[model samples]
Target chain A: MSLLVELSNVGRDFDGGRIVAVDGVSLAIEDDETVAIVGRSGSGKSTILNLVCGLDRPTRGEVRFEGRAVNGRAAWAALRASRIGIVFQNFFLLQSLSARENIEVALLGNLGGARQRRVRALELLAHFGLAERATLRPAELSGGERQRLAIARALANRPKLLVADEPTGSLDVQTSQSVMSIIGNAHREFGTAVIVVTHDEDVAALCGRRVEISDGRIRSDNRMTAMPTPAPTLRIR
Target chain B: MTELTLPLRGLISRPLRTLLTVLGIALAVAGFVALTGLTAGVQHSFASGINENGADLVVSQRSAFNLVSSAVPKSLSSGLSAVPNVEAVSGILLNITTADDAANIVMAGWPSDSFLWKDMHLLAGRIPAPGDQWSVILGESIARALDKRVGDTVELQFQPYRIVGIASFSSVLNQNSAIVPLEGLQQLLSREDVFTLYEVRLKRPLDKNDIAVARTRLIAAAQGFEVGDTEQFSSSIRIFDLLRAIAQTISLVVMAMASVAVANTLLMAVNERTFEIGVLAALGWSPRRILRLILIEGVIMSAAGGVIGIILGVLTMEMAAKTNFAAGLIVPYLSGWSIAQALIFVFIAGPLGALYPAWRATRLLPADALRRI
Candidate 1:
C-alpha cells in the first residue's frame, strides 16, 4: 500500500534546546496499517504522534502526509480536518452536548445540512452499539461508553487515518478491552490507517505491529506474532 | 445542526450566566430608548404645536432663547397684521411656574378672540369671556395635575381665579399649561404693552413663496422681533438641543457598558470550553469556524436582549406620557427609527464584543489544548 504518513529525521525541542522531546526520529505508516507506538512516560511517544498527525511541525526535518510536506499551521489544520481523526486519553467529548450531538459537531464543518448531519451521527452511534444512550450527555455515560462515543465522533467524517493517544488510559481492564476492540474493528471496517500510542502491553499486543520509543529515539520496531481480532459486538446489555 | 442547535446548547448548559448577560444588555438598551424618547417627545411637541395650529410664523423677542423669557410689544401684532398676505395676527404671554412641586408648569395667556385660543378644544366648560379678568382655562394635563374641575377656583401665584374651562392641546407645550385672558395676564405681570410672542397666519393654501415673502415683510416691519416659520421655531429652542445631546451621551455610555458585559461572558465561555474547542479543531473545524461560533453566541444574546428592551422601553414611555411630570410639556415618544437604531447598535456591539473572544479561541491549538486537563 502507499505510504500515508512519513517522517524523515524529525526533531522537536522545547525550552530553547534544553529539552529534546523527539530527536532524529524517522517513521513511515502505510495505508490501512494498524501500528502501535509503545513507550513509558516522557519517552516522546505522544510527541511523535503529534508530528504524524500534522498538529506539530518538526523543528528540523519534515513531516509528510500523502507525500506532501506539512509546511505550516494552515496545512496541518487542513489535513487534520479532512483526512486525520484523533481520540484523546481523556475522551475530550464536549460536556454540554449529548452523545449524538458530540458526533454531530464533527460533521458540522462539512458540506451536509442539519438533517444529513443527524443521520450520520445516529448511524455512528448505532455502530458503536450506543444508540440507546444517544440522548445522554458525556457525564451521564460510563467511562467505557464515553470512549466509544469519542471514537464514534472521531470517525464521523470518515477520516483515512485514526490517531488514538492512550485511548484506554482512563478505563478499567474490562472496559479497556472493550474500547481497544472497538478501535480495532473501526480500523478493519473503514480501512483506516491506525496509530495508537500506549504503554500497556495488552493494548500494544492488539495491533499488527509495535514501535517502542525510549530516550527520544526508537528503541525497537517489530511485527506482532499474531494479530488479535476484534470481538464481533460490544453490547453493554 | 451546528449553526442553530450546538451554540444554543452551549448557552443553555449555563443558563444562569446567559440570563444575567442578556439582562445586562436589556437594561442598557431600555435606558437608551427611554432617555432618547424623552428628548424626542419634547422636540415633537414644539413642531406639532406650530404645524397643527396652521400658524405661518412665530414673532418672538429677538435674542430670546425660550418662550417663557420672550417679550414682544403688543403693538407688533398690528404691524404684523398689516403686512401683505397676513391673514391674522395674535399675541400671547407665557411664563413658567411651580404649582405645588418643582416640575415646571407653562402658563400661557391668549387673547380671548384670537385664533390661538380658538385652536384649543375645550373639553369641559367655557373659555374666559372677552372682559372676564378672573377666569382661567386649564389644559387637560394641568387640570389633572392640580386636581381642579370646571368652576373650581385655582390659585395661580397666590391669585385665585375661577376655572372657566378645561382644554386639550395636541401640542405638548400647551398641554401642561393654564390659559388666561391676554389683558388679565398682562396686568398681573405688569407688562400690559408687552407680549411673549405673536402668531401670524397667512392666506389659506399659501405656497412656500407666499409664506417666505410675508415672513420677510413682518420681520422688516417689527423691530427687535424674530419672525420665523414653524421649522425655525422648533429648531431654535436651545433646551431641546441640549436635552438631545445629553440623551445621546447617556445612550452611548450605556451601550458601551452592555458591550463590556457581553465580552466578559464570551471570554468566560471560551475559557471554560477550551478542551471542547480543541476537540472541535481535531474533528475538522477550522479556526474561522471556531471564531464564527463564539461571535454567533454574542449576537444571539444581544438580539434577544434588544427585543425585550424595546418592549419595556415602549411601555415605560407610555407610562411617562401619562404622568403629571410629563403631562402637557412632554409625551415620551419612541419612534420606529429610534427602535431600529437601538437594534442596529446592539447588533454592531454584539459582534464587536465577540471579536476578542473569538480571536482568543482561534489561537487555541488542538495539540496544546488537548494536553490541558
Candidate 2:
C-alpha cells in the first residue's frame, strides 16, 4: 500500500514556544486506511490532525503528502481543495445559506456552473436522506441534520482524503452511531483515506485502526477487528 | 454562489442597520448637493444676468463690491461711448430702498434713451419716455410683489412715482429689479454727477480681437474705474465668492461625517461576522476576496444612498427655487455636472470609508478567525 501522509518527528508550539501542542510525534497513514486518533482533551489529537492535513506546520519536523513536502500556503490550499476535505466539530455551516447552498459552497471552485453545482448538491443531500431538507438553513435543521449536511459538503468535491475532527462529539449516542455508520460507509464505498480525531472510545472502536495520544505523544497504536460491510452501490451523480 | 453574493446576504440579514447607514449617506450626499448646487445656481444666475444684455464690459468704481454701492462719475459714460470699438455706453444707477411694504427692494436706474431700456421687453404699457420725471418701470416680479401696475403709484423711499410700464428681462436677477430713468434717480437721490456703473456695448461683426482691444482701451480710458468683461464681472461678485466658500465648507464637513458613519457601520459588520469570515477563509476564500466582499457592501450602501439623495436634492432645489428669500435673487438651477459630481463624491466616499474595514478583514488569520466559532 502507498503512503498517503507521513509526519516525521513533528512538533507544534504556541505562545512563542511557551506551550508545546504536539511534540516529537511520528506517524504514517496508508492509502485507503480508516484511522481514528483517540486522546483526552488537550492531549494534542486535533493538533496532530491539523499538522497532517497541512492546516498547521510542524515547528521542528517534516510533513509529507504523496512523498512531497507540504510547505507553501498556496500549495497547501491547492492540495486541500483538490485532494482533502475537512469536517469541523461544530459543523461550520454558513448560517445564511440553505443546506443545498452550504453543500454547493464546497463545490464552488471545483464545479463548472451554478446548475451543475446545484445538481451535485441535491444528489449528495438525497444520498444522505436530507433531500427534503435541502432548502432549510442550518438554524432550522437539527444537530444531526447539520452534521450530516457538513459531511455532505465535505464530500461534494469528491476528495480522496477525509479529515473529520470530533465529528460526533456533540451528537446523542444514537445519532453518533448513525454518523459513524455514514463515515464507515463512505470509507468502504469510496475507498477514501479517513482520519477521524475523537476522544470517544466507542467512536475509536468503529475504525479499523486506533492511535491513542497522551502528553503530546502517541501512547499506543492498535488495530482492531474490522467488520467488513458491503460497499454502497449508489455512486456520485 | 458567486463571491459577491455573501455580502449581499449579509446586508439582507441586517436590514435595519443597512437602511440606517444608507440614510446617513443619503443625508450627507443631499447636503453636498443642496449647498453646492444652489450656490452654483446663484452664480449661474449672476453670470447670465450680466451676459444676456450683450454688454462686452462693465466699468465700476475702483474697489466696488457690487453695483449697489459702485459710484463712477456719470460723465464717464459719454467718454466711454467715444472709445474706439465702443458701440454704445449706458449709465446705470442702483439704489437699495423700500418699495411698497417690502424692504431691500432693488431699484435700478437706466438711461431711457440707451439700448439697455430697449433690451427689456415691455409686457404692459410703454417704456417711460426719455427724461420722463417721477415715472418708473416695474420688473415683472417687482410688479407682482409691490402689487402695482401701469398707472398705479408706488412709494419709493417715501417718494411716490407713477408706474409707467411693466417690463421683463431675460435674466431672473434683472427681472427682480424695478427700473427708473437714470437722471430721475440721480435727481431723486440728490447725486447728480454720480452713477453706480457703466455698461459698455461693443460693435458687432465683433471678434475676440475686437473684444480684447476694446477691453484694453476701456481699462486705460477709465482711470479711476475697474473695467471687467462679463465673465470677470460675474466672478468679482463678493456674494458669489462667499457663497462658494460656504458651499465648500459644508461639503467638507458632510463628507467627513459620511465617511465616519460608513466606516463605523462596516467595522461593526466585520466584527459581527468575524467567525463567518473565518469559515470562508477555511473554505479556501482568499484574503483578497474577503476584502472585496467588504468593499462591495460599502459601495452598495453608498450607491443606494446616492440615488435617494439625488431625488431628495432635486425636490429640495425645486422648493428653494420657488422661495422669495433675497427677493428671488438666488435661483436654484440643477445642472448635469452637479449630479455627476454627487455621484463621483459618493463613489469615492464609498470605497474610502470601506478601506480600513476591508484591510482589517484581510488581516484576520484563518486559525484565529475560527476561535470565535
Candidate 3:
C-alpha cells in the first residue's frame, strides 16, 4: 500500500503563544492502514486528526497528501472537499436534510447526476443498516444511529482516506462496540486508510495500531493486540 | 443522487418559512413598482396635455395670470394675429368661478366652431354648436361631479344650459371646465366682443428670441396687457417640482422599507440554513456560488411580491377609477406606463435588497459554520 497521509515536523499554536495545540508532530500512514489515536483532553488528538484530514494547516511545518505538500489553507480546502471525508466527534449531520440527503451532500461534488447520487447514498445507508431510516432526519435517529449516518456521509466521496474524530464519544458501551464493529467492517472491506481518534482503550484495541498522545505530542506508537470477535447476528434486542 | 439536490432539498424542507420569505420579498418589490408607476402616469398625462394644447407661447396677462384663469380681449387677438412670425391667433375666455348655489362647479366659454375645441375630445355626445346657444359641454371630471349627462340641463348662476357633450382634454389647464358657446358667455359676463386669453400658436416653434419678438409686438399693440415671456410659464417647473418632491418622498420610503425587508429575510434564512450552506461549501461550492444561490432565492421572492403587489395596486386603482378618481390623484393620472414603472421598480429593488444579506452569507467560514450547524 502507498502512503496516503503524511504530517512531518508539524506544529500548531492556539491562543497565540499561550497554548501549543500540536508540537512538532510527525506521522505517516499507508493505504489499507487502520490506526487509532488515543489521548485525553488537551492532548491535541483532535488537532492532529484535523491536520491529517485537511481541515486545518500546521503553523510551522508541512502536511502532505501522497507526496504533494497540500499548500496551506486553499489547497487543504480542496483536498478536504474532494479527497478527504471527516466525521466529527459531535456527529455534525445537517439538521434539515434527511439521513439519506446528508450522505448525498458528500456525493454531490463527486457524482455524475442526481439519480446516481441518491442510489449511492441509499446503498451506503443500507450498508450501515439504515436503509429503512433513509428519510429520517438527524433528530429522529438514536446516538448510535446518528453516528452510523455520519459514517455514510464520510464515505460519500469514495475517498482513499477516512478520518473519524471520537466516533463513539457520546455512545453507551454497547453502542460503542457496535460502532467499532461497523468501523472495523469498513476498514477491512474497503482496504482504505482509516484513522480513528478516541479516548477509550477498548475503541483503540479495535484498530490494527494505537498511537497514544500526551501534552500535544506523541507518547507511544505501537500495534494493539486485537479484541476477541463478538458473536454473529448479535442483535441487542 | 447528485450533490446539487442536497442543497435544493435542504432549502425546500422548511416550506412555510421559505414561502413567507418569498412572499415578503414579492410584496416589497410589487409595492415599490406600483407606486412609482402612478408617478410616471401623472407625468406622461401632464406632458401629453402640454403637447396637445398647440401653444408655442402662452401669452398670459402678467398682472393677473393665474394658470387656471388666463384670458385676453378681442382687439389684442387681431393685433397679435398680425405679428410678424405669428401663424394664427385664437382668443379664449375663461371665467373660472365655482357655483355659489351648488358643488365644485366651474364655467368656461369659447367658440365651439373654432380650433380651440378642435384639440378637445368628446367622450360622449356631440359638440354644442353656436346655433345651440343654450347648450354646454361637460368635462370628464364635471360629469362625475355634477352627475350630469348629455341632454340634461345644468345651472350656471340662474340660467340653465343643456349638457350637449362630455369630454376629456389634455391639460390640467381646463380639464374640469363646464364649457359653452362664446356668445352665450359674453351675454352672461355682461361684456361685448371681449375675450380673456390668447394661445399664441406659431408657424415654427419659437425659441427664446422668437418669443421675445412676439411679446414685443403684443406690448406694442395692446394697452395694459403685458405678454409675459414663454420661458417664464410655470407649467414645466410646477410639474417638475411636484414630481421631484413626491418621487423623493415615496422612493425613500419604499427603498428603505423594501431593502430592510430583503436584508432581514435573507439573513434569517442564512441562520436557518446554516449547515446546508456549510455543506454546499464543503462540497466545492464557491463563496460566489453561495452568495448567488441566496440572492437568486431573494430575487425570486421579491419578484413574486412585486407581481402580486402590482396586481393588487392596479386592482385598487381600477376600483377607484371606476368612479373617476382624478387623473393625477397624486399627480392626477393613473395609466399603463405606471404599471411598467412599478415593475421596473420591483426588478431594481429586488437585487438591491438582496445585496447585503447575500454578502454576509458568503463570508461564513465552513469550519465555523459546521460547528454551529
What does candidate 2's lDDT look like per residue over B212-293, in tens digits? Answer: 8998899888886778876676666666678778887888788779988889999999999998877766665556667888
lDDT of 1 by residue, B1-373 (tens): 5687767877898899999999989988888898889788877776676566667888877656665667788777777888988888888887766555634676677887788766679999997888998798887877887888998987765567899999887777676777888787788788888887788888887898998888889889897677897667666666777888898899999999999999999999989888777777777787888899999999999999899888777777778777766666676788898999999989999989988998998887777777766
TM-score of chain A of each: 0.95, 0.95, 0.92
Q: What is the TM-score of chain B alone in each candidate?
A: 0.89, 0.87, 0.64
How would the candidate models be sorted by DockQ, starting from the highest?
Answer: 1, 2, 3
Error of 2 at A14 (Å): 5.3
Q: Root-mean-square deviation of each candidate, in angstroms?
A: 3.1, 3.9, 7.1
TM-score of each: 0.91, 0.85, 0.72
Query: Model 2, residue B240: what's the lDDT?
Result: 66
- lDDT tens per residue, model 3, A124-156: 888778989999989999999999888778776
Which 10-residue span in candidate 2 chain B carries the lowest summed lDDT?
B321-330
DockQ of each: 0.63, 0.40, 0.29
For model 2, the stretches where C-alpha displacement exceeds 4 angstroms are: A1-20, A24-31, A50-80, A108-116, A126-131, A173-178, A185-191, A223-234, B54-76, B83-85, B94-107, B126-136, B145-164, B183-197, B203-229, B236-239
Q: What is the C-alpha lDDT of each candidate?
A: 0.83, 0.81, 0.69
| Model 2: colliding residue pairs | none
